[model samples]
Target chain A: MEKVVKILLADDDLEDRYIMQDAFSAINLAHVPFLVEDGEKVLEYLAQMHSDEGILPSLVVLDLNMPRLSGTQTLRELKNIEHYKDIPVIIFSSSLNVIEMHECRQLGALSYMVKPFTYEEYLLSAQHFYDFCLSKHSFPEFNSLINNFK
Target chain B: MQEITHISLDTDMDLVLVHKRTMKLGELAGLSLALQTTFATAVSEVARNVIEYGHDASLMLGIMADLKEPDKFLVATIKDHNNNLTDRINGGLVYARKLVDKFSMISTEAGVEIILHFKIPGSQKIISSRIEQWIISFNLEPPVSPYDEIKRKNKQLQELAEKLKESETQYKELTNSLPMIIFSMREDGELLYANSWLEEFTGETLLQLNVNKWANVMTPEDLAARWEQWYHHVAENKPLTQEIRLKNVLTNEYTWHQLSAFPLSDENGKTLYWTGFIVDIHARKVMEQTLKDNRELQEIKVQMEEKVRELKRSNLELEQFAYAASHDLQEPLRKIVFYSDYLYKNYSALIDERGQLYFNNMMGASQRMIQLIHDLLNFSRIYRDNLYLEKTDLNVIAAEAVNDLEIGINAKQAVIEIAHLPVMFIYPIQIRQLFQNLLSNAIKFSDEERIPHIKIYALNGGKEIQLIFEDNGVGFQEKHLDKMFSLFQRLHSREKYEGTGIGLAMCKKIADLHNGTITATSEPGTGARFIVTLPKEVVV
Candidate 1:
């Protein structure tokens, strides 16, 4: 059987969460992306998976503006964990600020994407995220793959 | 004895006249030139003695006949009433006695008298009648030779010389008493004379100053430049007036002084010497420098004020931009999210009836948002873009604006009356936008009861130009005039007049960019007039 590609997504806005779900569903991935309401829920889900000895998600998508443990803070805590350090993280934000994007990248985010205003653009961004999980390479090579999205 | 001529011994010139008379008498007597000189010399000595020691003195010269022998004597006798001559006559009498054939002196309580005799040679015989002729001839003598005239002139010149010396001493005293330094120098830069003031001020003697050429007393910083200027003036043979620093010996501090020198030239225009004076000018120079520095400081203060004003203006613009972004931009986004979520959750039910209305409302809000963003970008561009002013005709711009709004004008059947406008230096593109916005506003707000008549005209104020846009439109109340030009302030409801409400604000911004003002006056349901005043000449 093909290995299921598990993805975790975190966002604060309900509408943005719904749009991301639809975008992911349209791409026909091997498994559904696990959704969380905020950066704190992402951490709780990771802890539960670790305690239960479940498989770690291959990729984590985090929204920059979220309550309790923002995307950059979560990335820092995730990188500090020995087992979760290898999990690739991507930062999704509505702010088109290059400085915030650079800060997120410095905190171990593998890629940064501006949240698309339309469904079609979100669908395209979702395809790039799925491509990130499939392509196995060094962090630098993976970062360059989605660099044009910035 | 016979008297030929005599002069009173009152003055030294009288003594010279006495000598001349005696010489003439001796020449008339039959004495040789040697004898004449000898007898005149004896007579002058006794006469000088009588003049020195006597109150009234006179001399007599004549021939004396002796009955005992054939010898005839020429005699001279000096007499005075005052007998004070006895003590002073010894030396002059002894010398006279040796030069003459015979000499004698007698002093008495009444007066004193001196006598001298020279025997006339027998070959040059003299008679009583000849003595009368000799007296007449002596009276008629014009002058002995040029020597007499020269002797008289020499006496007058000596007296004049004495007067000149006295006046020169007075001049020296005057210069020494003056407060300033007065000096004279040779054309070659050697110091000739300096008044006592120079010595007192510098604590150096005139001799020392001459040797040093004022090098030690002058400030070193001013020395080289002063020398250069001095040489230039010397070369040009011109007067020099310059301010320089001089060290005061007592104070040991340098102070500003004005050194002025003029060349003392001869009739031939050759520079003989330079006479100069130095006066203190430190206080004046310091006051002038202070005034200049104060003026510069005032200029800097004005520039700083202008900078602060510009900063405040830009800060206000930034605040407005932030407000529009956070409020207007986010409003539509929130609505779109709300509507989309409702549709996604109730997709089957929303597709029946109310779903279309929700979609339409969402689309309208988004379109309005896009328009607001576009307008905000344009508004910000007015601040960001560099304004280029070019000389343009106002008539051409007005015509172009009308042409751009042709569709609107035809749809409303609006009539635009443009007066002949003057050419002006202005930002053509921005001014074009201003005209288009104003014309469009006038057309959009026209009264439906009346045909819209728009008049565009300009007036020439002396230092500024006034552009007027008058319209017969359904105008606003005067109370709302204050909010007319502010960003996003709508005077009418959105259903009545469709606008993002940035037109008048943009117009105000454009006016401010040109350093001009825009104001409007209106009465409810009547008409409106918008006036724009711009400087006749733009600075930048």
Candidate 2:
């Protein structure tokens, strides 16, 4: 049976979403990539999945800057929820300050990646995004990291 | 009398010669007429007396040459039938002597003989050729009874009084009726006369304004000055200009008045009076005082506003400083923490002990971050909290601080020398905390070669008590003295001098709350001396 790997992307840009969609199609991924426009939508998507399907996302991609709720806010809110709190939220942004990077980690974002200006960087990010979904998700180790943070 | 046609009498006559041409006594020729005029006026009084009492009296007349000088005299003879005529004739002779230069007379009860001489102004010879007779003498009756004497005295007195009244009326009209206070003061400040101006300004009548009564109306302040200025002005005969505050007689309200007076004097330049005119200026005086008070209040308000602006600017600077530290310095701290944790976690077996030590150093630097945050928070809290003041004894504070730090003091064998302290108004807990921090610094940063000898001495500087803390420690260079009181400002390595570098800075904040100053002095190897100057007169 084919693994229906679940993927989530929290970003506020329409053009970035369109470009990443094309890059993921090139990799021929079987899983569905869920794209939310803001941090609040990202939390809502995760909570809806826990309540309706009884399943958590394999991975989540977060953008640092958004209008009302940013990627850091999404990470903090997800860490507070009990059922979906252990899921890994990766940080992606156009401009990254080191303090913000550390702040994201402290707020429970698992990893960080710089979003480059060129289309080549977007394709590379898309390749890495497909690999992140395909790799078998580890629940025990990520759950323990969340436990240490608390 | 030869050919003398106006002859009326014979003087030393040879009566053997008579007038060849007789003339009436009332009609006479030129020179003779002139001579008769003189003769007539000369004896008119005698003639009136004679005609009224002893009528038809006569005198003998002649001319005689002086034997000694060039003057000549006319002689006249008068004889009257009255028995009292002889004495009267003698009186007439005295009258004739005054009229001419020389006179003589002899009289019997029947008639009198008088000699009157006429002399021209420059000629010595007598004018015997033109002699004439004009007057005669009579008896004078004695005065009447005592009642008649009184009546005559009364008539004279009435005439004298009429003259005095005329003069007084003229003076009164000349002095214009401005309800004058025409006063004459003696040189000794005695009021000689004061007029009705006092009665007009005050309700006092002229009779009530006697010297003693007017003196009673003077206010106590005026009496204290003794009217000395007015007295000197009048005494020296100078112009008087003075403003005096006096209470009105009827209203009892203080009225400021200005008196301008000129010295009145007689033609001989004597000081006769100080004639003054007064004008009320109470309203102007009040306005001037109000202007002065407003100016003082405005000055105080401007100073207060300036101090507030200064305080606002200082507060802005403190906020800016904290924000700048959080935003700019915080990024570097994140890099340190991130890299150190990365080196230890990802490459733990690959990195040797030296690299481990580097990571440890990075961690230590990151840990000083909390110190910076704490010091800034403490400074901000000082600005935010309400200051409570207390009467504090510095001696007790120092003793308690020494006892509390017995562990550190005994370990380093620290010798703490204290001095006499003053009782002053302060924040008691703040002062004790200040002592604890400073003593800890002295004990922590000690000399490697010797026991920490902390000498604390205080001296009263009249305005403030200056306390000096001297310690035999590994002192810093003088170049870093200014940075010693900055938050997290470290001059030495943590391996050498172990501290968060906030103790001295916190002590500085406490001193600032007391409106005091702290300064440090040190050499490379010699000990350090920290001087704290606190004002004794604290503003609570």
Candidate 3:
């Protein structure tokens, strides 16, 4: 049996959080997604997972614009932690700003994804993200799977 | 008139006696040495003619004053007793005609008479003789020795030398008194003469000055180029003019001077020497420099003004873009939210549960986008509109904002305490918007259990007015203070706080529009205090 993938999502918009959670459910992927509203809670959740017997997520999805600690700041903080460096992070934003996208990449984001306008585009990206995670864990040699999103 | 002197002309030796007597008359008449010789020569010629033609004759000499002249004339009359003396008088009158002012023959009934006139020197009129009758019978002295004639000639030459010396002294005084430095340089760059004026200017003697060593008194940087120009003019033997800086002996500092030179050429066009003068041009050069600097400053001022105009134009362009983004981009987003809501209500049963969820999410997103656009519109409108400022009561503006937020205030159970505010010059709409945004934020971010408490007050800060908004509610962390007023920056999740993240940004924009400043102080779980400072007089 394949191990269930645990994914952490940080987004300030409630609708966007619901959309991502729904995308995971509609795709029927074997994943447990934990959601947080902003970058500040994301840090709290990560620290709780370290202290408690909670399992760390295989991937982290971050929205660029949030209340307090932004996605770039969180990425910088996550990369600074030696143990969390290997966990690939994906940057998601509603804006099509290439400068922000490049800025996230420089901050060690594994992939940058723009929020889709339609339900169909959302479903396709969710399926792609799920398959990337499965390929990332099952075949460690295929870690370059993030390139498909690029 | 002088007494007449008579001399016999019978013997050839007697003509010399006539010459001596005529010369004596010249001396008594105060004639110059050259005129005295002329008078004596005329007398001898007349006496010789009388001797050659008549048997015996006598010469009478005297000085006679005329009516038209300041001085007298020397008159010599030869009386002849021989027959037809007028016809016998040959070239005597011709010789005397050239030497005397007048020569005439008077033939009387018994014999003939010849009268010759010589004008004394220093007479106002050169021809001082008119026809006059005279008769004299007097004895005159004989001629003096040759040594006496030579002595007179020597005295004349000595007097001429004195006159020449006086003229030379006057020329030297004229040249030395000039203000300019006049100098003469030989073809080989030798100083033949430098006037006293040059010596006074340089505070040095002309004999000690070196013509080729002018570079010693010139500025080092200008020496080589000016010397090359000087040498080129010399080689070409052409008249040249140049301006240079030379060290003033009096001031010991470099000063501007203009040198003008003319080459004195011989008949064959070979340059003999160069004569020139150096005139001070320091004052004129300074004025020229001042004009040049002022012109350059004017050019820079024009360039700076152009740059400022360009910056203003670019700012106006950016404001236009913001206005367009809010007004045009919001319409489509509103339609999207409306259509999504309509579809969800009318066709919910046909779509699956997951599809229904996605539709609701889309509608929520569109609604948020519309709110974002509305906030942006207000932010840009504050800058885009032409300001109409007037004295307005800020307390009344705050009350209106609170009245507009009554619904939200009641829902949050918030209490807003307002103090008396001052009347100041401000844009009414923008000031009202600022108050509304701050009031809405205070009511919206209250704690769940405790009722929100807010206070609005004003204080005079000397040159400026300070308006303070204090809220006892859930505040942001101190670390996020810098970004509190940035556009689309929020400290709480959208679910917890209903905002498009533009309230504080709008407030900041309103403050900046009035040429004021806005700052906030807050800590996590503590209350927030926002302070706005505005000048008493708005420049705009």
Candidate ranking (TM-score, best to worst): 3, 1, 2
Badly placed stretches (over 4 Å) of model 1 are A22-31, A123-128, A136-150, B1-540
TM of each candidate vs. truth: 0.38, 0.34, 0.39
The residue-by-residue lDDT of candidate 2 on A4-112, one tens digit each, is 6777987787766765676577577534577889988987887787778756777888888787998888788888988767777788865434456668778877777
| lDDT tens digits, residue span B209-273, model 3 | 57446655777779778768878899988888999887778888888889998999889988889
What DockQ values do the models have?
A: 0.02, 0.01, 0.02
Number of the top-ranking candidate, with lDDT as the measure: 1
Lowest-sum lDDT 10-residue window in model 1 chain B: B326-335
Displacement of residue A134 (Cα, Å) in model 3 is 67
**Model 3 chain A, poorest ten-residue lDDT window?**
A141-150
* lDDT (0 to 1) per candidate: 0.79, 0.64, 0.76
RMSD list, candidates in order: 21.6, 26.1, 22.7
Evaluated on CA atoms against the true complex, candidate 3 attains a DockQ of 0.02
- Model 1 agreement with the true structure over B266-336: per-residue lDDT tens digits: 89988889999988889999999999999999999999999999998987779567645754465347446
Which 10-residue window in model 2 chain A sums to the lowest lDDT?
A141-150
Number of clashing pairs, model 2?
Answer: 28
